[model samples]
Structures are given as C-alpha cells and as structure tokens.
Target: MKVVRSDWSRALLVCGKCSKKLDGGFGPKGRESLAKALRRHLGLEKGRRAAMGVIEVKCLGICPKRAVTVIDADDPHAWRLVDEGADLDAVVETLGLIRR
Candidate 1:
C-alpha cells in the first residue's frame, strides 16, 4: 500500500450526510456546504493546503437539526455542530485550526 504523508498539523472531518442535508446552507446567499465554504473561506487547496487538512467523510451518525457535525482530528474528545452561514472565521478560531 502506498503511504501518502503530509505536513498538515490539523485534519478536519466534515460530515457528508449532514452537509448534504443542509444543501449548500453556507457561504454567501447560503449556497455552500460547510466543507466547501470553509475551504473557500480559508483559501485552502484540495489536498495540500498549508498545514491543515479538511476532508469530507461518510455520515458521522450525529445528524443535527439543520446543521453539520464536525470532528476535529486534533481533538476528537469534543465535536462541533456548525450551523449554515455561521461565520467561517469564528469556526476556525473556535476550533483552533487557524488564526485569522
């Protein structure tokens, strides 16, 4: 098996199921999912974006009402429930993923 490595210090796993449920409830005009919106807001690349990794995974089994559940690889003890269009900058800061 090929082992791909990266310098990303942080990895965020966004819930695909939840994101789909909201149907692009983030970003301007509420037309972007949490993952897409976060990537765009942070100006991050698809694979190698700074020292952070934001990937969408299968359902996390915590389907919140009109929100997405996020798992921060850095700290799995605590999960985050992010609402659509809820300030991306604030999210990043709260998660300690990046400084804006």
Candidate 2:
C-alpha cells in the first residue's frame, strides 16, 4: 500500500457566494476576500502548509444576510458567519485556528 502523508497544519472553509456578495469585505480598506484576509492574518500560505489552509468553497447552504459563512474543518457541524469589518484576531481565535 502506498501511504502518502503530509503535514496538514490547519484547515479553513470559506463560503464562495458570501465572499462574492461582499466583494472583498475583509483586509485593508475591506478590499480583500475572507480567505485572503484570514490567510494574511494567520500568516499562512495559499495551500495546506506554512500555518494552515484557507480554501474558498461553494455555498455552505446557510447564506447569511450580510456575512460570510465560515467552517472550520475540525468542526463542521457549527458554521460561523463573520460580519464585515469584524476583528480578524477575534475571528481567528474563535475559529480555534490561532491563539490569543
């Protein structure tokens, strides 16, 4: 059996529709996607490495009115709809991806 193993680090799932609807509601001047903002805040690369993985996925089905749906791979049952201009540090910590 071929066993392929890699250091997964951490995982994040961002809603595509929500991100698109907001049109980059994160980052400086609110001109960055949720995934990008999280990535920058966590100092993670574009893939599953460095610090973790920030992946933009299709609509998670919740579709918040004015926020993006975010799901931590470790905990998918409960999703988080992050509002615009929210604190990145708080969000990161809440998601359990980063510490205080």
lDDT of 1 by residue, 34-58 (tens): 9888888877777864557788999
lDDT score, residue 7, model 1?
Answer: 65
- RMSD of every candidate to native, in Å, equals 1.7, 2.1
What is the lDDT of every predicted structure here? 0.84, 0.82
Enumerate residue pairs that collide in model 1.
none
Q: Which candidate achieves the best lDDT against the true structure? A: 1
Q: Which of the numbered candidates is closest to the native, going by highest TM-score? A: 1
Record all residue pairs in model 2 with backbone atoms less than 3 Å apart, i.e. clashing: none
Candidate 2 lDDT score at position 40 = 85
Q: Where does candidate 1 stray beyond 4 Å?
A: 48-50
User: In model 2, which range of ten residues has the least summed lDDT?
Assistant: 43-52
